[model samples]
Target: MKATATMVLFPELQSENDTIASQLLLLPQNITKNPCENDRTCNKDSVNINVVWLDSTSHSHFYRSMPKTVQILRDIKESGSLNVFSYNLMQSLKGGTYVNTVAFTSGKIFSRSYLQSKKRGIGNLFNLFQNGGYHVSMIDDLCWTWSAANCACGIPTFMGVKTQSWISEVVLGKRVTIPELWGNFSKELKLRGLNDIGASLANCEIMKANGITDPFFTGKSKVAICYNGLYQTDYLMSSLELLQSQLNRANRPHFSYLDINLGHESTGRRIQTLDVSLAKFMSFLGRQNNTLTFMFGDHGNKYGTFVQKSKESKIEMAHPVLFVLASNDVATKLGRDWMRALDINQNRLVNILDLRQTVLSLAPNVDVESFPINAKYDNHPNGLFHPISRKRSCDSMGIAPEAGKCICYQGRVLQRVSNQTGVVVLANFALGELNNKIQEQFLAANGNESSGFGNCRYLIGSWITNVQQTVSQNITITEMDIHIPAGTGAPQSEDVFSVTIQVGSNIPALSTNIKLVHHERISTYAVYDDCRDVGVDGDLCVCSATPTLQSWHIDPPTIFGYISTVINLTRYLYIYERRTPHGLNLETSCDSADKTFEVVMRITSKVNVGYSKKYPLTFKVKHGTIFFIDVFYQLNPKLNWDVKYDVDFKQL
Candidate 1:
């Protein structure tokens, strides 16, 4: 139930009024309060901290993909309304949204002790803001439903403050149709009459065709992270408008957390649509003389075709976008020294921990310029508001050697090692971890019954596919892919896993030096009839029942048609020609000697029913391994070659 200004409780909506009252009594007595009205004079001591968080956006991707957004941001920066700090702003941890957000909210790295304590609100920004006498609100258009701060998705809750307001798509507990949602949004637009920042309905018909009209229409409680839709952005736009109304009516200092999931949730697809809406939002903030706005990304796109394309993609994921826009009043109050520090620290090595400190420092009358000497996070003692050491590296910032690919570390001088023993050791370690995960999943599925993984057999590494290593400051980073053979009776397919590990200089010391940093199953698992949920990640499971393995040879025309259908290039007709069963394309990047077959194809554009010219294409397949076949074409001389089609052999 929504809490009102008078703290009235609706009997049907909630039963926790007494609990909320008791919690309010625990608040400190010295909560800051300025009797001055919400005007320019009130900004002398404090300003509302309005944070707009965009998930999974990297600085590089934001600049490259969202041209209009970048232009607006550039204009704001030139106008001295925004600060863009793109470089050296790394993620506090290597994990996904949850980990980075934890650091952002709590100002601490995630640990077992923190989880064990179960103190969700203590020492967090929510409590800090409340202590500063700010009316706190967390708003999200997708994936969050706040009921006493508990996330509906079973992740640990945020805030845990009962008085804080939650505005989310799932808050009402009843799913509405896309049209119904749009009607409500239209009514809200009429009420506010801020039509300049209207919804972006670009590609609306296409999105509808792809079943992406409603934010909550996925049949799940929350929208999936990888899902894409224009309505998601529209929902956020409407929600932000509603938040503006709330802020206007709020008398106390406000701390608003606007969790915008448009760009990142869709895996960096259709982010251009957010440019106009965000530009307007920034403009609105620019006019708010007493507001300090933070518009930043949690991290870059972690899982997508974009991230897997090149090494630069990985670097982009490490460097998230951070823009701190201080209103004119707040900027003047920060003084020249603080402004100078903000400028210098833009290029300094910073992360979510530092951002946490920065937010904490902004609390009313808090002067924690430096962290305690013995504090666990003492390495990076100050926030962006203070001067940061130029000599500080990832190590100095207490970033784990395996935490992430740090921009400060120049030791990623990769050298390919042939048949290294360390590769085998790390591969085996990763395989063991995968098997252990499978066992754990099985145990959990069966209500913690330790009767073993009933029908699932342990995966054994059949052969190593690829290995590459880099040594940076006595730390060795090894990336290897090993093909794990499916259990007997399962489909005749190999499950190739790409694993990354970090170790000390003593690579042979498998016990203490080795640490598995990242691992994922690259190949697809075709059969899981008996143990569907018992696999490491729902795909590595191999049922005990033996299925008939059928091998069929397709005609040339049939192969071409299959390729054409899967690629979805309606304007092209393909023709496949087999070179040889043992043919290997030595000129291509397919260096594996175990390649089973190679084929050449000629693709022709069909302007109408007639075929245009034929373009020769070649691809080599390593039988049952994970590989990407990229098809490129240049539509015009001035334009760069576009990757027209990509085929993942595992999916085939």
Candidate 2:
């Protein structure tokens, strides 16, 4: 028998108020006859569904033109219906468009690449259903792939669907096979496979095969029959109508899940046709007097420019839309404490685990009293039914500051507040004692080379750059661009910096491969300013040296914007001041004739942000700005040095 879930679909576009008011008339009102009074097919608490996630709809994408959806909101406001609240969802840093390292993992010291590979052990979120004898089914959609088929591995597969490894079975500790009996699933059962079949007719067949009370549905199929219908308008609309007709017949609690794609592609807009159709479905379900519903948005704007604008903007994208609706009996059966908490938290910080716990509480067979008080992934141990503290910190919730978003009032965002860390900027010479430390690290890395420390000496040079600062107690983090400078005021976009080394007819862009990462040993309290070409008469030209400067203390830099990973050291070479005959011939242009008597190699690396003992240093920073320095070195194998490049930089 085809499955007819108690949960119904009300998928709509993002909020578009005007469109909602006009387009709602287009929604179908299928429940014209009242079965409640005559057929005895419905009652006051037949279904206890706590979730109804409409494919890709989030608050940011909620369309105003959907009449049915808008009407439901209006009805809730007018009737003071079962308790509903606003929830905040966390975001992966850098939004859904760019695949960065901070998307899934949440520790401080981590690379997103290596961390994602270790999340394969999936767990059972449906053990309660197995004990309660309730059937769980899913329509073909993207969510089955992300939330189930792949078991939250962050969709790393090429098809953006199942990892084809039976991951759900592994996690749930039970079978989660598809309805297809044998062989590979036909392309017909996948997304866009609807062809011309009505969703209702298809579901009726499943109902015949699997009786309402059948244990494990015989084959333990996961009801993953309908594939990727979210992309098609008619298919989704038809599916909604068909599902509603059956739900109107539903007399027991069951689970149905589906996902829809709006084709936003991160453009920050929604389809008008979808809004009305979903609203209609939602409106129909809103009229039901025997059901409970939970509605929410997944991670927002998986692809878009709005995702990277600012921290607040990132939070906006991560923040999802959430709502809960129940009939009078269902609401009352939920008990007194849950009702009180729901009434108090109209707008509160929420995580998905809380919702999962609530679903478990509704199951009849599962021992709710034995349910674990805390979940590994929850913001708190208790579910939404319990009163979660309004003052929970993101850190305790295991949310990485970079990948987390929480609710806050004006002047309340903790990132804007200072951490009470003090940093004092000092002259380049202030760290002269560090020269020994630098030599130790350089020798350790290259000492094994044929001509290593004997020819290559450590260059202890530094330059001061600009840091975005606000006089107000709060610090507004700004973007750290990837521009590098060869000399003072001469910023270049080229990341692969190289100085040509004239070797026969070959003029390769060979500059010593030197990468600067943040050094934990170097304190942010002291920073050296970049040197400039100041004429020391015709006999000698002097580069601008460090002056006694006041150090400005600031707060930690958030990754959304501030990240000064690379600094300019071109001026430290003192080549900008030396005439044709005075210093090493250095050309800023890549096309210039090759003439390098010293170091030559290419350097490539990303800017380092967090500083801890776990990772190696690639650059040094002060007051939240990375320093750049240039020091000349000889390419000769001989240990004797003709030009003390390290000393020259030290003198500057």
Candidate 3:
């Protein structure tokens, strides 16, 4: 017995021409012929794939943000027609949208170095579908620009099929004018009654008409329409309608990829607005037996107030939402064991690579049972067609640190290490790696560009705000929040970065001790105007500032000190200056035999102090029972001073 679901739609939001629900109701209730006799008999030409990639939405977020959509999905899953993967981890947490897309499209692991290399010749799933005589179409705003800016994975022509470009003209209204490459596609949209969508996008006029007073859209390009008063569902509806147009006349099979930036803005809270459209789309898919839909997200929130709202918000960035909806006929063809595997893999650690493999398994003449049902490492892809190891580690899945920390294991928890010395060293090291990546990206650009490396200022580590780590079996994973002076425009403003690194216990070998796994700028870098097209992570760049007069007032210089627990240490060093010197240098000397630890200096400025700043030096010696600290400072060659002190930790 097949279960039925109530169709949900927002009638007030629909146009008069013909409702989507009404149109779906007109389709055949049952497929006349089996698209594939069984899983082993399906040809690519007989299987239709409709993929909807939602940006910045995670598994937890989907349920919290869209209760209506979740209920609809639950109904489908209960009907035994849908398979939901509870643990679909993303390939990259910090690589952004472009890197994640390329990973699944090619079914390969992507790294910052790989994207920087611009290596080509890797075949993609789209090309496979095209070669199998399937009609292929991709709809997105920035997909084309992202492809052109990076590797040439044949994005424009996947197997020589020209991708449909729907930028400025369709995505942004005519208020923002730009040339359209595929002009005929716009006409096709008009014929399909989707011409109103472009005009309905949030624009200056629309904002005024709707009485929206938020300045969020002021400096942003017309393309960045997060809180534009208009619901983002407009783009989703248009894409689904366009896909519907193809299905109406599809002779063989059709593959349509809809990658939209609908839920990326507003801390991803905007996903709630997609409930009605999403419910309708899923309802329509429920009636089709030959089509398969992959609805998922790239990663979670990268920035905004929402990420700082709670701990769950921060963790969701690595846990993207993935739902695979298969028709009843397709499910039956895949067999009972495959269905069992699907049930088991939902809770296992899986990613886009596995999704790609599962799609390929449906290709023509692929024996479904050729691969073992219980094999740990199947020679074939590790898709849901077989079981994914519950013990899978991120490294085994070819995941890099840039993707985010692994959450699959139970005992690998990252706890606070309380070592300020180690935090400072690792923070600086991570910043160095970030800057090197920025420099490499800048150097890769041809000299034709005006905004080059010279336009951006290199970032420096200001202070270590938070330090955390977890060690198990001699392996350590450390996370830190470091502050830097990469702010928008304020004189004393700063930006905070969250970094995660892995290290071995070889404290003596600090040179090869720490490795950066993931890093993200938690604060906004809106001041990236000067170096707009520099081709590097814009947040990593701080535009160079014009020369300004520098002055500092130094009252009688004084030093303060205090001693706390062995696990906690605090020291304060205050410096006041009247005139800025050519340079300032800080040196530290320790009277301990072991050189495993070092001192860290934190710099701060106070506007109330009238041109005076504070410098607090903190030290930690983990190996020695007792140690002496000597510090020397020089405002300039003319001014020099030194402070020496020793304390015994053995008494504590």
Candidate 4:
């Protein structure tokens, strides 16, 4: 017998229009007729094809009414090779209850509540799948949507699928074993093979090979299961279109199936429309002899919409969903029996747990008893009506079944709303701080006062003080005034002025040397009557009596000289007076007035090293009247550091 293959399509957020369009495209061009399609005998006698579609919007309904679905799947699995495909539409929706909770609470110091709630939901789903014996696969829509954003979490929705994969590895008998019936007595073991021979052969193979290939490789029978994480409407539409294209193409296999989760509320309504449209498309595909198809939502929405106020309220919003199946061969085999079994009029409640039973029952030569069955439904009143009726009893406000149109509890509703309110507040706070800093920096660098200077030059210098102060403290210096002298008439009316500005500790360093140049004035007249009538003797007179002189100061002066006296001192501060390579260098200058004044100042200014604390040093004027001074220094050792990583897999 040929092995059965299953293809599962997990639509994250699919709408009815999207599903219908997809179905139209997926419909097969040919059809074949066969009787007893639903009958177990007919299915087993002929080649069988089975497909399962699971959607998130129908999940609750499926779970509540799982017995019939399970029985049908079991029949398919038992009769022929089983092929299964599943999908989740909610995975594609922009936001889910758990996802929004994660987003809102992320990075918040007091937001464990949202995380805990999401974990709980995921944990419940995990438990449900693990208890069932279905092999699960997942494709996340969130990962696809934000592929360029580099989200920390790889995939966001259907985490239960990943957990189930892990569990399947442990529980599914993936190991080769010698049956107890083939038990080896000492004599039989010796007769079959020498123990050393088996061990030696294994050792030689291991030594020759790099590694063992995966034993689970199913070849062409590969089954892909996925869940749409947080997909947009357009994405869901495109995805369905892709699926339809694949199904219609003759070159590809016809037996593939799809499973999807249509999320709650709007997503659920959208999936329902998809189901109806896909049904028509499946009817077309049924024309093809080798094709089989099925689609359904996994669970229904508890709330009327995808967006909910709180996790607790969402719990109350759960509902049951619907499933549809189409297969030409299977329907003909069972004939009336198949119709009787699938009759929606019978009203059945089901859950995902029945999948194992359904698949096992469809496998060839497999006894139904061989697989475990926790529950089954066959027209039982309590079974069919109990869960659904109970769910419908509550209204939109989630009042108790007995409340029946009573005044809604405002407190309860408000509390739920409050739970999500914090997210908005925190987002606003972060944005506000970011805007404030941006505005402050813009004003300081480009305001009215600094505009006319063309470009304000930054003075870079460092000073080490024994005092320990917070970064908030402001540093100011009293000396070091650079001014344009009064009698120089040096463009005084132009907004240019000579003022002493102190370089603060917070100022960044510079790399190149700086020079200051002083231009002597020819006359002291503000502006001659005709503007150009000053003679040479008048210029001399301006230079002597008026002493139209100017001074310039350049610290760490390698390119420009610093002015010593304020006599007729019209000072101009010229930054970037010269350029040199990057590093720290010291310059010495001395002057005498019956005493030598020697200054040893560190010239540590970096063009690119903006505002750093690690490069702080002291500037001192020592040994007055010395022509030159010797200086010694070292690079800060704290600047160069490294970190290490250690891993111990054994502990794990």
Candidate 5:
């Protein structure tokens, strides 16, 4: 009963000898290539711009934690540093935790697939500058993965390797077995005319007697930034002093980016005392000509001294420092109206991507201000590097509140509701009507929880305070015992903790309705054998590595036993006491992801435990991309190139 079109009746669809001419006529009108000819500022000739970018890692909220970083910033403010700008609460393009993602891709659509394509090129700046005839070189104490074949470097090797490492270190208590160098970049640079001036470790010695090892000059077209101090220096002060010295050496009328890895990532955990040294550098640079400077923190110290404070205080850990200064000449170049516009945006928000947009404006060929704000996306064309409205929300800037670490409360404060919506404790009489004393303790206990807190989940230090309202009413008391982990010796090893609470209606209660209520919060951490490398730049403890307790809340911290079982009990024992990992950790809150894991765990263990197993189980289909691993792993070119999908969840 099938019909076939084997006859010549469909001859109109056939190709003719002049098909080339016909094909050109069928081209789509909307798509075009490099369509910037119409802009008055779009000049096809070579650009005239110079830049010195100093890329630092970590040290968020430096202004609050390190007065020295601020003093230097203040000095820059008095100098040619730009205005205080923000990435508008944006996280790194690769991931939320920031360390693993591309350290510098802003305003670009990011996803695993998108990243695979962009991975060949480390950053947009490199390409933009190189095309504009600039020689770019990075001088740092750390080796940057810019323009290489690895994640840290821009190389297009399999991400599975890093994904495995990311999972093993964070989710499971496994060693960092991923290979740091997978495959060599096909060429020295992904694009022609770029250079990896290999200046790291002690190679800064190369730049000692003379300048960079190679001639870092070519027709005055050069963009280079260097980091002097290091987190590994005997004293952080020594490094800061070194950094101050380096800042004094930038005697050019170019845009310079400086990143001091002080207040280093969680690993250094070192107290930063940089005010005096930074002040000297800033003061000196403030008097320079046609210079622009910026001072900011990458992120708060991951496991710094103040990480365990209240939610408000912990927020500072997420909010990094940001200050900008610029010279008079540079101000005039940006235009006087741009300067006046800054007045209207006194307290606007910012993020890293916005920084990207601002930097893009520096390229004279791409005239960003020629167009209005993106009508569809709501982003300002000029970005924060110029002027942004004070009322700009994270949405307008394309930075989500959670990802950008935005702390604006926006009037969402907590208060008591009516008794019908509050109140109640059972008559078990164990805790006696859940009086004000216990409620006050939990409220003031920095929430004493994180995930499922609204439903009264208990985590040791997460700060949960929303349920105090219902505590005032007569409520029934409920009780539950915490399961303690077991192992004991001169070094005790057991994960056990206990908790009791009252349960009732109208109050947040961790009742049995939840999907999976169990112990163990899976956390990802950049642990290292040399505890010193804990929070170093690149977040890769791949060098001297060890398995660390992934939990940030653990005071002394937990790490795996380096020795074999029972060989050296004390050696393997956790330095800190155990808090039953029984509460809801943020990573485990993905209900669907949890279900997937639980099923996988069941199927694997079922056979070993003599239980009937459904090797191929039927699961409900969600209205989104449901990937089968085989499709991605086999390197199906057609699928890999075209089958990518993005899932956007809408909040109720």
Candidate 6:
């Protein structure tokens, strides 16, 4: 046998004069019979979930005219079935202010129906629920339905007076009944005793005393409903805590439903302000194995107001209500089936009205289809109906079909500035002998003395020197100087050389018009060598050669046509002399000699002066056997590499 389930219907904006009265008329008939014959329990099923529509209209006069509804609620509670209570309460804050303004301005001109209906409905609902005997309760109040039309004009003004009077009567143990302002319309508007306000508080205390803390009241005779009122942050926080605490204490499964009206400023802000509270509550619900919960908005509100004021008939205000239901154990067993049935894409036109049916379907021994509304209900057809999809009219503007790409709605456009300009091409190459050989080969083959390294070289060569090298052994001396002899016929003096080894490289081809005055001076030298023969007994040798300049000025006379000689040599000779008769015999032989040479050369290179170019000849040196030369240039009046560009708006 299946366990009994409960259903609660909480409706906001249900008027007592017409809507409420008609719904109440239909409830007794609906509750008496089982509409579905397939299920045997349908015939004998008890009402697990009860529906209580709060009549907030009577709040101002609840002490006098709330007996009927109160009696009805108590009678339902005595049946040992679940009581599902649902209703909206007056937003004492917003409604009261609006009501007072209208009453004061219109005086006796305003129809009494507006205030009378609201007062009666709210007063009756509150009285019924407060006195109703239900283990669980859901109050749908100011959280949803924030329109001023739903509230009384004198709410703010009358609530304080009424609350005090009600409290006094409660303390005095008096039956504090609201005045019958509608029919009799002749109740004295006098202040009540202190005991009236105390009585109301006493009722609250009594309700709290009987209230079960279980949020998911899975047992029989439990009540769950929604509250409709303007929910402030503090109120919501307290409400959630109360619900959570009740669920924790009840030790039985229960569910609490809340309508998050995102369109209501206070309600929306309440959720946002206390977001963590809601999260904690949801997490608690999720962990309860026996609980099933649902949250959603009844309908969307207008953009500027809580009420729909536009005259145009559009579905924008009616489409796509958000629905979320969560359960642990039940979901684990029948989650897929339930999801399939509830899936928006399955073409089910489920709306606020379907809430009752869904809850009834989950109840034990209840046939959801037996209800007339559920029986005649044709599920929304495929493609035409979806839970998450809503059809909106396309604009008639010239914008493209795919112009807007927003998931929710269009937002403000953000303007941005373009920071990209011309492309900067960078070609990185090895900085050692390999790159030097490539550059030297290109220069020697394309040398043009007059046209500035000619067109083959776009920019002068620059050196990134004093680079720290990583090696185990140092084979060469720490510092070595290369000297260039001066003038044509002058004997090449090794000591008095024209060019001084100024710590670093001197390459003129790199100089540009923008950087003609500045030059870099080398501070130190760094060297690296491969330890090829670590344990070998022979001396390690390295060879290098380069050309030098005879003078600082360009086109100077060539000295000895650039002499190349073996610059370095180290000999290791062996001396062996036999002792005896041959007197002293000496034989000496030397090992292979290490050699190096320097050669001077003049090359033409191009220098860029902003947008223009000029030809210049630069002096450089080349290695003898290595067949590579590294050229480094110094610029005059240091150049600023910051490039700027202009874009034509017309082109855009």
What are the TM-scores, per candidate, against the unseen true structure?
0.60, 0.48, 0.63, 0.27, 0.46, 0.28
Instruction: Assess the local accuracy of residue 221 in candidate 6 as a C-alpha lDDT between 0 and 100.
Output: 9
Superior candidate under TM-score, 1 versus 4: 1
Name the runs in model 4 displaced over 4 angstroms: 1-54, 58-257, 261-280, 290-293, 304-319, 335-339, 375-652
Q: What is the Å distance of residue 396 in model 2 from its true position?
A: 3.5
1-652: candidate 2 lDDT, tens digit per residue: 2222222343435555532311111233233233244545433333546345543345555633345575666666467654444454322222221122122111122332233344322233333443343334334322222222112222222112233344344335556555431112223122211111223223322323333211111122222222223323445455654554554554434444443434223344443445655666566555665566776655454323343233343344456556776666667777788877765555555655556566656666555567554433443333667876666444345433233343342233332322111110111111221223333333354432311112112222222221122111222221111112122121221111101111111222233322121111111100111231111111011111332111111121221122222222332211211111111211111111221122232222212111111112122211211122322223332333233222111210
Q: lDDT per residue, candidate 5, 1-652, as tens digits?
A: 0010011010123455532211101111121223443555543332223222222233354444457656655555554353433232322322222232243433444443345444333345555655553333332332222121112321222122343234335325455332422222213343422333222222223233124332111211112222233222222123222332332242211222233343433322233434454555555555554544545554544332233223343345345545555566667777777656543444555555555556666653567665344342345666554566555553354433223233343322323322122121111111111211222332343332311111121222211121221121332222122212221110112222212232322343322111111111111122221232211221111221222222222222122211111111121111112111111111111222112221121122211011111333322211111111111111111331212211222211
Tens-digit lDDT track of model 6 for 32-68 = 1223434664323222122212111222222122344
Measured with C-alpha atoms, the lDDT of residue 254 in candidate 1 is 71
Candidate ranking (lDDT, best to worst): 3, 1, 2, 5, 4, 6
Model 4 C-alpha lDDT per residue in residues 39-58, reported as the tens digit of each score: 55443432223233433343
Candidate 3's displacement at residue 149, Å, is: 6.7
> Of 1 and 2, which scores higher on lDDT?
1
Error of 4 at 417 (Å): 23
Please say which candidate is ahead in lDDT: 3 or 5.
Answer: 3
> Positional deviation of 626 in candidate 6, in angstroms?
99
Question: Which candidate comes out best when scored by TM-score?
Answer: 3
Error of 5 at 337 (Å): 1.6
Scored against the true structure, residue 597 in model 5 reaches a CA lDDT of 22
Off by over 4 Å in 2: 1-46, 54-58, 63-68, 80-84, 88-122, 140-234, 247-250, 308-312, 368-382, 402-405, 409-652
CA lDDT scores, all candidates in order: 0.49, 0.34, 0.49, 0.25, 0.31, 0.25
